[model samples]
Target: MTPSAVDLSALGQRSSAIVDQAGNLARYGMDDVAGAGVRSGESVTLQAPRTVTFPDGGSITYGALDHLGRPTGVTVHITPDMIGAGTHANASILPPGWSGNGILHNEARSHLLGRQLGGSGDLTENLETLQQAPANSPVMSGFEGQIRRVVEGGQAVDYLPTSIYLGDELVPRGITLDAQGTGGFDWYVRC
Candidate 1:
């Protein structure tokens, strides 16, 4: 079942510091859980906001690692030039709890900012350990397709993808995506 607005509000508040501005934690809808199927997990966002600008002028802002050294998430500004046949060449620098043979073990060294969206596999803080099902799910791919379409059409998209963890769990329970494009499209998906 979907969580209530009040419940999400309370949950976000009680979790780590999510408010981008000071003294604004009570503004519910601004930071309300984005999707209908959002479950009971801590919501993460761009904690450190460190931007890595590509040669093509596209950029991705990576969040800081949590206390447990887990990635908080990423916000990416994607352009047509940023999308390509992405690489998986660097699997050596993945985070803790990643099985060496991730696909064989039904786990993934997943990217918070997906490689298809110009994210790097080399950054440990940009990676997370995830189950293979959700990592490759149709729902997840659909959201990614929307972002891709906007960028392919020569529009820029500001996309935020957050990894949601339950307590001290090394693997995330789910991911949350918030995307807005210059093409006048906005989407929020939970997968």
Candidate 2:
């Protein structure tokens, strides 16, 4: 059966459950930290919003911010369909102040799943912290409209034609295309 034939409602539900559980765990973990009092320069990882899977198998993972912290933005996982007839496999949009070597990817089902770096900061440091952050730490808050991106080293890739709801507005500042392709990107609330 084609991917479309598969009933994703159940999968979506399961995905939601997993996301919710992660968020709850992060909250609980944060509660412990809060009990002891949060420290400056101390970063906590919180559960992001649910991963919204598209009918075509592409998915977008939301990021979170604590009430007293800042988050860069959410991560976008694109599928082959989302990539369209693109020739290049290695592509990404890095955030501002990104000092990383390159984009990260994991191969699955003979396809390379690129992990777009979401949020802006020291790429090396942020990536390390993101990997090290507890699975139960809360995400930073108040980062709904401040996302940006810059293309890094790689062959020019086709932009994904899609629109997403970040809080209450379509992304890319009135455009519905995925402009975060193979480079540095950032996001913040627009006045």
lDDT, candidate 1, 55-82, per-residue tens:
7678877787777778777777797767
TM-score of each: 0.70, 0.22
Name model 1 segments beyond 4 Å from true. 1-49, 55-57
**Top candidate when judged by lDDT against the true structure:** 1
Q: Note the Cα lDDT for every prediction shown.
A: 0.62, 0.25
Q: Write the per-residue lDDT of candidate 2 for residues 64-169, one digit (tens) a residue.
A: 4333222323345443333332222222533222234432421111011123322222221122112111121221111111121232233122222111113322
Candidate 1 lDDT at 161 equals: 78
